[model samples]
Target chain A: MTGFTTTESLAAYMPEQNIDTDAIYPARYLLLMEREGLGPYLFHDRRFHGDGTPKEGFILDLEPFSKAQVLVAGAGFGCGSSREQAVWALTGFGVRCVIAPSFGEIFAGNALKNGLLTIALPEEVVARIGAAAQRGARFRIDLEECILCVDNEIVATIDLPEGQRMALLNGWDETDVLLQEEGDAISGFETRHRMAQPWLFQGST
Target chain B: MGRTLYDKLWDSHVIRSYDDGSALLYVDRHLLHEVSTPQSFIAIEKKGRSVRRPDANLAVPDHVVSTTNRHLPIADPLARAQTQRLVENVARHKIPFIPLDDQRQGIVHVIGPEQGFTLPGITLACGDSHTSTHGAFGCLAFGIGASECGIVMATQAIRQQRTKTMRVNLVGLQSPFINAKDIALAFIARIGANGAAGHAVEYAGPVVAKMSMAERMTLCNMSIEAGARVGLIAPDDQTFDYLRGRPMAPKGEMFEHALTYWRTLPSDADAQFHRELTLDVSDVEPHVTWGTSPEDAAPIGARVPSPEDLTEATRRERRRRALAYMDLKPGDPLEAIAIDVVFIGSCTNSRIEDLRAAAAVVAGRHVAAHVKAIVVPGSGLVREQAEREGLAQTFLDAGFEWREPGCSMCVGMNGDRLEPGQRCASTSNRNFEGRQGVGGRTHLMSPAMAAAAAVTGRLTDVRKLMGGKP
Candidate 1:
């Protein structure tokens, strides 16, 4: 997990809402345990035709957009399914940040865990970014300042929760937080809770 | 201030809170499945950490296992490896496991409730999105990713921020043909896919309160499709009755004690919600999705919506893409849209009640010669119950393939899949492109609707076929 601070790249625009995990990476490819090499499989069904040839007009295949490391999308960007493979596929495809009006809760969490920054802006701002991306404009997302910029002009100031922002900035996994705990407090709480509610742990133990 | 059900649940589970509004919350039950657990187990082994609370975890292999022939080995190497990995990890950690051949072995969500593993006034987590299905018992259940699953496996706690509460009050008398699946679909269609995003929905009002436990499960099962992390129904007599004699339920005196606690799990009378919406289901027909998203749904008699009907340019573009992928036209009626296959099973609608509903529609009727229909129960217990009641024979006699329990055609991971250019009426939750198979088109609907589609060789209205006025 590499800490993310800033990235400037050509923005890829996918203007569809509810772009679900199935569309991100289809269920057929979910059998593999190894998460690597998923970039080519991202949107495989939509990006290619039945004969194993790339579709001619897909945005990812177009010039300039092919090198995009930032994605601008509509609302509900990663809805449906809790597959972490969707985040791995996006990161594997070199997308370091996703800008959307909103995102599916689980997908957003998965993205944060994988060090992929998910920025939620106002709908109008996202639409503007989408329009600008269509005109081949490069955009930058600065996590430290919580600002999105195009051509050195600040376009939108995004607000991310402090905890998530720090997690991405420090590349801190949840395990790292857990390891910081001394376990004495947790054990003390558990003992008191068990004594108070003995019935709760009856079947569990 | 009166707290909502979600607030009460969250407040009870908080072990410690941080300034960032996130809390370390205790998890009462953890459900594990094959596809999501392998990576988490590997990560734990790499960290040299053992499962902290094996007693709180229950493991099963359902996603990749073959739904046909229980005695045979899984043919797909990847699926076989995943199932084997789960078995090995569970044995190594001494977690409670239900093997494939066990009568109790079933879909994770199905087995949890049936075995008394999922109860009210507790918090549950699983690696699959449909974990919300267990919320039918008034539990705060939601899905988690692989890493989060690993955390829960190690600490029996999850870090989380509380979500706002949304109350969806279904206010009308539902028709007999309009089952819980129809209610869920109609609600999604009205609210759109992202309508409930960032909120926990508590279903109330006359329609929801009247539904059976199975029906309530059906309603909560598709909450993920609506972008809701959790969906709940207050515990009532139906929920308690359903869990009374289950194998894992509490014994005599303990049962009475548990019931006293369960009765107190409902939201207070004057509880306030962050958002409230009421839907009148008096005239909702048996609903089905005509396009890729669950929100792109309509009554069985309606035609597909045109891109022109959409006000937003992005939505119009999405509709155009969906139309091109589905090979469907704007004016084409949802009914009489010929389907190549009919799949009547998934976590959404594979319980015993769902099977009985489908069997009733196909009791003496034969399937269309051109259609391929299959019925996969949700669990081994469901399969046994169906067999005992002769529902399996009814399906087999109607030319529907009666198979064992697993997530078969709902997801195309297993051998069950549709070929290119094939269209299907599926009882599964998702209808995204290639969800059933690569290049496969799926129309989400209820079991009864799928059964009627199988018999008519097209998407037909179940009511019309049942001798009701169209």
Candidate 2:
């Protein structure tokens, strides 16, 4: 399990809210039938024209800002369906962390599982960070301290439950978690079911 | 401190908690559909296991077949195979099967509740995501993977985890013309998607009690949007009354006993929950998804939001991305935005009530010449009932194509699809790109709203089509 750490550089940001899976990866790209090509189409509809030419005034396509990773957004973030493709698209597009007032319940799961650190700050703090990003403020998020610290100053504290923090920091997928407890679960099921269903296991291997 | 519907169901299902964090929970009812059962059926075949408690399992074929021509061969080979496999598996398992031509045939979620099977204080699992629709009846319903479905088939149960209870309380009577779908959209958009993941959400408050059973189903159908496994509304007198006389419902003295138990299913007011979210239904209006996600919605009369208004990380990025995909100029009125197609079907809003809502709009009017419009009912029974009531003819007379039951254009996969760059107003569960077919943009809305889109070639307030609000 890799530590869920981020290299937050001091950079100002582009802002928007209510982002959805389709915008992250358009349907045309999903036709590729593989998760690998998905990243290229991340914001493809928003950043480029039908002919693949760059669209001017697009927030993601803007210089310096285009390279920026951390984003500050409004409350109720990741507010969409259970499509984990959105997270894959975001991480594939190079976003390492998201700072929002609140993250969408499913998107948070997808993000945390994929090593995308979600920083939930208070609404006022989120607004301040947005303003700072609008003015091109750059900073790095420290997963260990759980803060979005900017050039020798702390911008915001991000709170994740200790368990989730550990899961992210250690890259624990559902398979990994299941495997960790498989032995105990199987043994307990057998021992408990024997008494309840003695006839069913009379000749079990 | 009131107990939420989810808490009650979860407590009732506990067989034993395991040390490894999962629990052995008893399943009261198990629902199966075609899309996710084939692999499970194959697995069971390999294991030489017969479906345990076949009487407790119910099977319906939805999600893949076309509603365009029920009698005709399923044009898509993949869908045809899936439908065929469903028949074979269910027959072998000896469960009650509802095929396409059967009067009971419909979307699994619709049939689950309408057939008087989805009861309160029960746990149900189906392969389809929209199975959450059963939550309207106080059932703890959720989607499961194919492997889990196989387990449920062979053993009549699966290990389950207790869920945190999240209470969603609505306040005030909804504004005029605002329906349950509007309130649901508003709730998801308010909390953002994923607000209720890992939690069982209970729909409460006076506004919920005011809703009809079908309306409650519509509100609960979008539970996935909130990241909740299911959305539940406790059974009240209204619920019992709706179920008491149904064809499959318990009758006479047995019905009375069922009612006594059903009434007790609601939590006694002092029940506690892990979390609570509240909303005032009066503030909700005709809503539209401005962006690609269901949560990116705004009131129909509102303007497309600019990125400056967004203060969160992924949200800002999402808005920027949605604007790009939609090719919308900021500040554009959502209602005025033109659409190319209008699809009125899906497990979400394709019930008989939805057909009635849409028929009210198209009865006296023709669809827009440029908008390719169609009305697909959710079930064969709904289709027959609509025909008997002249609803189908009314839609056809309004220049809207009428179709049979199947998940048409909702998730593509079947013959139905939209041309690239064409935008549609759909009553389906999602508005994701290509979700209806590649490059097609879906704007999720209610049936009446879809009818309005069909009539106007743009998103319009359904009140305009109603001639006045109902």
Candidate 3:
């Protein structure tokens, strides 16, 4: 993994509402042996024509957006399905941050865990983010600072839970929760299971 | 001290809470699919962690793979690979799996309930939003993120916050034609989409009691549309009887003991609730959504809401936005809205009964030339049963496509999608913009209503369409 965070903004353009994980990465791509090659195929089935020609009119095919590192989107931008591949696809497509008016409840959780930033602005601010992208304004986000810098002006401030913030900063996964407990939980679970509810673990084949 | 469902469920599972808010939730069941598990298992390999609860977890390949002949090669290479990864991962981890071609292979939500693995009074988490459908058995089920899925896989526990408890009392019985889908839509119309936010909803009352298990499941499945984490119905004889003799259900004495325990899991009469809502069965009619979001729904008799009538700041804004995207006019009769497509399927409303109900509407009538209608089964079993009853042929004769399952057009996961600017009458849950494909508009309705739309190519009352049909 690269040690440095890329400071570029990705022009994440989507038609409004319920942008599902399947569109982010089609189920067909799930066959790929590795996550490494999934980025280019992100929205491949949609953005590419049936004959494999690029859909010239599609938003992701436009210049700068094709290279966008940050995405600004509309309401419920990631709703419907709970596939975390949506998060991986966005991240793999070089989007470090996604600014949407609203996010699907589960998709936001996925983005939080996978070191991607999902910022919730009001509908007005979401439009402004997209506008800022179109105008080629420098939209710099300070994940630790909670500030979205657009054209050197602080356009938005977002808040995340401090623990999630720390996890995102360090790319920590679920095991970090257990590691934080420092080996106390297992013994405590055994004691609790044995003493109070021995029957829970009583079954045997 | 708070007794929100989040707390009750949390307290039972917490090993301990750190200085932070998160704690380990003892996940009773973990259901996975081909798509999410491959990367997680890879992540597990990278971490050298073995799955802790292989017995408690289950995996299946539903999304991406075609539901056509099992022996036929998957046309989509990526789907084939993900499915293979899942198969190998299950084999390596020794977790039980229902692979393609397996009799039990279906959408995870459908397979789990039919197999009786989704039981009462237990916590169920899957990497799919429709996991909430399992709540019909009185279990608290919701979709957990993939990271949480991995957490559950490695330790059989994940951190959590809980939801407040809410009761949706469904009083009285519906007329012969009324159904659980109508009641569920009525609930959304009354409460609004975010009405039950951060709540665990329980559906009760005589209307609920009269509902078949499939009907109850349809109601519980859409609780997420109301922003509830989980929706539950009390475990009753109906639930117990449904569980008896199922392949995965407890055997002999174990079954009797489990039934007794499950019967005890219902909310006691004296139990207090944080929030309560009541809906008269007589109040609900065949339902559909005219605008975006599940909440923008109304009964068949109601007209589309004008923005001026939505005086609430949030609603006014939402209504205005919905009007723009849906191209719907205020005061337009929701019944008058023409539909280009009618889709019948999804984890929400694709059981055999839904098919039979839809078939009853479309049996003698041919679909309007302008309407493109399709029916997808929720599982292979449903597809087989639907065929055995000649329901598929009825649909086919009525000019509707009889397609394979796997959440088809419900989320537009596969190639089956509504074209841009197409308006559809759908039996799936959400009506949020682009839910069934980009630029596609959905008017959520019952299966019968969808069938009516298929015949007339518009949102017509199903009862009227039922006039001549058997």
DockQ of each: 0.66, 0.13, 0.27
Best by DockQ: 1
Preferred candidate (DockQ higher): 1 or 3: 1
Predictions: Cα RMSD each: 1.4, 6.7, 4.7
Off by over 4 Å in 1: A203-205
Tens-place lDDT digits, model 3, residues A23-108: 57654454565656567877776688646788766676687677778877766666656777777787787778888877777787
Which is the winner by DockQ between candidate 2 and candidate 3? 3
Specify the highest-lDDT model's number.
Answer: 1
lDDT of each: 0.88, 0.72, 0.76
Q: Model 3 chain B: which ten-residue window has the lowest total lDDT?
A: B1-10
In the range B91-187, model 3's lDDT, one tens digit per residue, is 9989888878875677888888888788776678998888889988877788876667777778766665544688888897687567788888788
Compared with the real two-chain complex, what DockQ does model 1 have? Answer: 0.66
State model 1's lDDT. 0.88
Residues A64-143, candidate 1, lDDT per residue (tens digit)? 89889999999999999898889989999899999999899999988988899998888888898899999988798899
lDDT of 2: 0.72
